[model samples]
Target: MLKNVLKSVGEYKKETILSPVTVALEVLLEVLIPYFMAVLIDKGINTGDMTEIIKYGMLLVVLAMAALAFGALSGHYAAVASAGFAKNLRKRMFYKVQDFSFLNIDHFSTSSLVTRMTTDITNVQNAYQMIIRVAVRAPIMLIMAFFMAFKVNSELATIYLWVIPILGIALAFIMTHVHPIFVRVFKTYDKLNNVVQENVHGIRVVKSFVREDFEEQKFKKISSSIYKDFTKAEKMIAFNAPVMQICVYTCMILISWIGANLIVGGTMTAGELTSMFTYTMQILMSLMMLSMIFVMTIMSKASVERINEVLIEVPDIANPEKPVTEVANGSIDFDHVSFSYSQNPEKLCLKDIDLHIKSGETIGIIGGTGSAKSSLVQLIPRLYDITSGTLKVGGRDVRDYDLEVLRDAVSMVLQKNVLFSGTIKENLRWGNPNATEEELIHACQLAQADDFIQTFPDQYDTYIEQGGSNVSGGQKQRICIARALLKKPAILILDDSTSAVDTKTDAMIQKAFIDEIPDTTRLIIAQRISSVQNADRIVVMDNGRITDVGTHEELLASSKIYQEVYYSQVKGAADNE
Candidate 1:
């Protein structure tokens, strides 16, 4: 885990190295300052020599300034290193997500990914800065102060030997108990994020159902759970300060009482006792800082594990070593193909799909929900690889071709139509970035979207809200179809994309498909019989297998499934009238 996380500290190695170097320099000067103070007190003040006092005091002032300079430099470099490391870490995670296959993405929830990128990374960043600066300085400062204390008078320094062990046991107990609570708290954070994202995305449905009160109650429960967990963790960590205070005060009182008696006995000098008091404060203060560092490290350990999971995960999909660069033609052949989202063959979602489609053929697929109609088309683009058998697109195995080359040749308009927030022209250009204004209007015209688009004040230049929320369902579908048309792909698959449009508009879009782009192989999946009535051939799917295949009239006479669906829809329309 440590090795994986440190890989993202690229380009910031100098800053990371400089932070600790400066911190060590600052600690050196700070530890020496008290020693010089003892010298000025003993040799200069005791003898009533003004010259000796001036010399040592001037040296102390110069050392103090150097320490301040080093401390400031350490702070600046620590900030730069940690912030830059976080930026690089986020960038790597985001780009890794982009490369994940559909199977890879299915394993993680959207809320979990968002929380990891934002909150988890932030925690790691803060912990890293503290580790480099405070963690480095505390132990060094403690050792230096303890050594100087022993040099002044070894007897008083022995007081720390017992106190240090007592503080260590207390801190270790708190960290062990608090760490499990912190781990649970971060998992609760995932649930909190999930609630917020779901509520915001489905706000219209929530308000329409009059469930605002219910949502608020749900949010409060998760929020309260997080609060309870944090409070418990904090209560445990709060034990550290009191334990440190007890040790600090006990050592201070013992040293004062014991040293005064030694001074009166003419064994210990007053100047050495004073310096021992200063070193005692420095040693105890260093312990306090170390305790804080341990607390932060415990809290961030869970975050580190979560972040490292993403950084180390290998993508399930990648391009072939020697990829085929070109697609031969629109022709696709699925020979003994089978698929399952899981690795176990017993859980196959599609079974034994064997079909051969010629270039420029228009095919329609119809099935009940979960029949894997969409799954069949998805394989052609290598969105999810077939578990067994050969799936070919453009007469070459999809896995053999470069991923970008194959996907570019096959344009798929998914069941759930999506449009990003942009102008109509800008969204259309996703299919073809260099598409001219003329080409944009032409694609929309073929999809029968140009008329509705021109009705708006800004026409093609109008801004679309996120997820195309400002547009009606039918308008969104037509716009998406227009976007797909701009690709001019060799093969186009529409997975119930026209369901929102009226039958007349659906017919017009189909007619335009036949009139223009005659050589493009088209696969249309729909629930309505009329949508596929004019296709060259229709495929009926059931339980992950093909039940029947024939043209419209032949299917009406021969296939039981097709006959039932066609008549049911016709009867429903007649009853409405």
Candidate 2:
């Protein structure tokens, strides 16, 4: 755990070193304050000469003021440095997760990844801050306190020999009992995040199905788990303050008893005894601070382990060694490609899939619900690595090109649509950052979005709510299509993108694509036969295998799979109309 955490922080070696250097400077000042108290007591109070007492007293004042200035300076530096480290860590983790292929993402849920990025990052943040300010100071103050007391009187320092070990034992017990709860607490957080995330995203489905009561109960189960685990950890740790206080009080009383006897014996002077008492108290306080740091360190260790899991996740799909730079032409071929989501590999998502798509051709992929239509398109973008076989994009192996270059050559409009909160223009600008107003309008016109967008008072400049909540399903799909069209990549994929639009609007949108995007190769996946009827070729799929392939007319005549799809969907559409 320590090795992994240090490794991530080590990525910013200069910043990591600067952080500790700054913090150590600040804590050095704080450590000196108690030392001045000893000096003031021993030099000024015990001495009879007013001149010597006044001189050292003024010097102590100067030291205190200087320490304060340095402390403030160190604190500012630490905050800036720690914040910069955390920002870099967040950026790296986000990019790494994005770089991960689909099969890798499948190993962790969306909610879990969110928790890793957010809660786990905060956990690391707290530790980073505390470690900078407190970690070294606690131990340094502890050692210095004992040395100061030993200088005043070795006998009095011996009292700590007994008390410190008992404090250690108590702290050890707290650490042991709290460690397991920390692990369980993260799991509870995962459950809570999953429930809340799903409920919020799928609120419409829950309401339509009238499952509000069921959803509430489901949330209760997860939330209750979080409450229970958090309480358990808190209860165990709460014992530390009172237990440490009792130990300190007991030591204080024992020291008073021994010191009183020494004072009566005239062996220990009044000023000497006073300084010893102050030093002992400083030692006790420093020990408390040290123990608290240890507990915090333990908590962060657990968090670090969780975060390190993600930080160390090696994407199965390696980035290209010497990547291709040129824009790939819209041509793809799968040479006996076989793949699965899992290493234990329960069931293959695609098996022995061999297909060729020529440049500028339109291919419609038809499949049953689990027939891997979306999965097949995912391969062209290299979202997942094939288990066995060669997959080529533009005559070169897909893995031979930089992922950015490969992705830039293709655009995929997913079945699950998402839109950021921004003006329509801003959201669409995501597709083409340098696009002009005219191009935006043309793309919107092609996606059949211009009409609805213009109905609003602001048109293209109109603001959209998060997730495009102000729009209907068809409207969102059109906007999503417009965004993809603005990119104008060599290959365009519409994965059930037209499902929300009526057949007539769907046909109109298809017409716009054919008219305007004449040179781009297209792949459209849909359950409706009409959506694909005009495609250059159609591939019918079932249960992860290609069952038939041909043009619309050829398939209706010869292929059983294509004929069944045509009969079911075309007949259904005709009856509806």
Candidate 3:
């Protein structure tokens, strides 16, 4: 996990290396200052030698200034390295997500991924900064200070050995108990993010239903759960400070009492005892810093695992070793194909579907809500691979084709029309970035969107809000259709995309498809029979199977499912009239 995460340290290695190097230099200078102070106090102050005091004082001043410079440099380098690491991590995770197949995305949900990239990465970044600076400084200071204290007097230095073990055992006890709570807390954070995202995205629906209180309750529940977990973990971590303080004071009192006796007995000097006191503080403070490092490491360990999960996740879909680059035609052949989102044979959403379509054919599909109408068309573009049998597009297996090449040849406007935050022309250009102005207008006209767009003051330059919130549902659908049409694909699948538009506009859009793009194979999925009634052939589906396939009039005569749907719409229309 550590190896995978550290791969993102790409160009920041220089700063990462420099941080520790500067910290080591700063620590060396710090260690020397205490030793020189002992010399100044002994030979200069005690013996009344002014020259000796001046020499050591000058050395101490230079050491202090140099240490300060290196300390500042370490901080700067640590910040740069950690911030750069986080940027690289987020960028890599985002690009990896872009390459994820639908199945991979389903495995790790949107909310979970968002938390990993933001909150989790931030935690790791902070841990990294501490690791290079404080983590390096603490251990080095502890070892060096202990060595100098032992050189001064071995008996007082032995006190640290006993205190170190006591602190270590206490820290270990706290960490082991707190780590599990932190893990649970982060998982709960994912739930909290999910709740906020859902409530924000559906705020209009929530408000229309007057369920603000209910939404608030939901948020509070998740928030409260996170609060409880964090509080529990922090309570355990809080024990660390008191434990460190007890150990620090115990060492100080023991050294002070023992040193005064040694001084009276003519064994230890005043200057030497003073230096031992300085070393004691340094040793104890380094251990305290290490305890803090331990706490941070425990917290970020869970985050590291979460981030590494994303980093190491192998995308389920990738181009074949030798991929077919060109689609021969719009002709598609599904030979006994079966599929399941979970890739489970027993849970298939599309089953034993044998269908063939020629290039430039117009086919209509009608089905109940869960009949997998959308699932069937989604397979053609390799959105999800089939579980069994062969799905051939342009006379080659879908897995054999380059993902980009196949998707470019087949444009699908899904049931939910999505528009980004941009001007109308910019959104339309998503289908073809280099589309000419005339091409954009022509595609819009074919989708029956040009007339409405021209009414806007800015026309094609009109800015759309995110999700096209500024536009009506029908307008959003028409604009999406125009965007899809801009692809000039060999195959176009409109999966109930025109449902929001009036039947008259839907008819005009279909008519334009036939007149303007005769060579493109079209598959239209619609609830209303009138939308597909004029197709060359209409397919009636039920429960993941094609129940019948025929022209509209033939299906009306023979297919019970088709006749039922047709008569119900006809009866509903007459009643409304």
Candidate 4:
């Protein structure tokens, strides 16, 4: 985990190195000041020599200013290095998510990924800054102060050794108890963020159902969990300060008592005893800083593990070696394919799907909600790899093609009908970045979207809210269809994309496909039989299996399931009339 995280410090290596170097210089100068004060006391003040006092005073002033300068430089370098490191880490995680296949995303979930990038990264960034500056300064100061005290009087210095072991054991116990609680708290944070995201995205449904109080309670529950866990962890860490204070004061009392006795016996001078008191404070203060570093490290350890999970995750789908670059045509062949979202054969969502589609053919797929109509078409673009068996696009295994080339050749307008926040022109250009105005209008016309777009003041240039929130359901579907049309792909899959449009408009869009792009293989998935009645062939799916395949008339005559669906729909229409 440490190795992976440090790789993000690519360009900031110089600043990372300089921060600790400057901190060491600051500590060194600070340690020397107390020793020089001892010289000014014994050689100058006690000896009543004005020259010695003034010379040592000036030297001490220079050391103090130099220490301040180095301390400020270290702070600046540590800040820059930590912030830049965070930027690089976020960039790497985002780019890695882009490469993740649908299966990969399902494993981590959207809310968890968002939490890892945001709150978790902030924790790691703060920890990095402390590690470079305070962490470096603490140990160096402790050792130097203790060494100087030993040089002054070896017997008195041994007091710190007894206190050191006791303080170390206390801090170790606090860190061990707090770390697991912190880990659990961050996981609760993921749930809290997930709740907020779901509430905002579905605010319309929530309001329509008048569930405001319910949402508030749900949010409070998760928030309360975090608060409780954090409180417990903090209560444990609170022991650190009092424990350090006990050790600090005990060492001071011991040093003062012993040094004064030694001074009275003339074994130690007044100057040496005064310096012993300063070294006692310095050594104990360094230990206090070290305890704070331990606390920060315990909190950030969980965050580091979460971030490393994203950084090292291998995308489940990738372009194979020596991949086929170009798709020959829109032909798709499913040869005994079986798929399970969980990759377990016992829980297969699609099973043994043997079907053949030629280039330029128009196919319609109809099925009940759980029948896997969308699953069959999704394999063409390799959005999710098949669990078993061969699935081919343009006469080659989908795994054999480069991911980008294969997906570009196949255009899919999914059931969700998403449109980003941008001008309509900008959103449509996702299909073809270089599409001309004429090409844009032509595709919209084919999808039966051009008429409504022209009614808006800006027409194609009109701004669309995120997810096309300002538009009606039918309008969003039509705009999405037009965008897919701009791709001009060999194969176009509409996964129940036109469900919101009226029958007349739906028929017109199908007619446009038949007239303008007859050579493009079109697979239309719909609930209405009227939408697919004129297809070259229609497929009926049930319970993850294809139960019937024929032209519309043949299925109506022979397939019992198809006949039942057709008669029910026809009776409903007649009743309406």
Best by TM-score: 3
Residue 431's lDDT in candidate 3: 99
- The 10 consecutive residues of candidate 3 with the worst lDDT sum are 30-39
lDDT: the better of candidates 2 and 4: 4
What is candidate 4's lDDT per residue for 371-419, written digit by digit as tens?
Answer: 9999888888999999999998899999999999999999999878799
lDDT of 2 at 365: 90
lDDT of 3: 0.94
For model 2, what is the C-alpha lDDT against the true structure? Answer: 0.81
Clashing pairs in 3: none
Error of 2 at 471 (Å): 1.4
Poorest stretch of ten by lDDT in candidate 2: 7-16
Q: Every model's Cα RMSD, please? A: 1.8, 2.7, 1.1, 1.6
Clashes of 3: 0
**Candidate 2 residue lDDT tens string, 222-244:** 88888887788888778888878
Give the TM-score (vs. native) of candidate 4: 0.97
Ranking of candidates on lDDT, top first: 3, 4, 1, 2
Which ranking of candidates, highest TM-score first? 3, 4, 1, 2
| TM-scores, one per candidate | 0.96, 0.92, 0.98, 0.97
Candidate 2: list runs displaced more than 4 Å. Answer: 1-53, 343-346, 570-577
Between prediction 1 and prediction 3, the one with superior lDDT is: 3
**Every candidate's lDDT:** 0.91, 0.81, 0.94, 0.94
The digit string of per-residue lDDT tens for model 1 on 429-538 reads 99999999999999999999999999999999999999999999889888888889898899999999999999999999999999999999999999999999999999
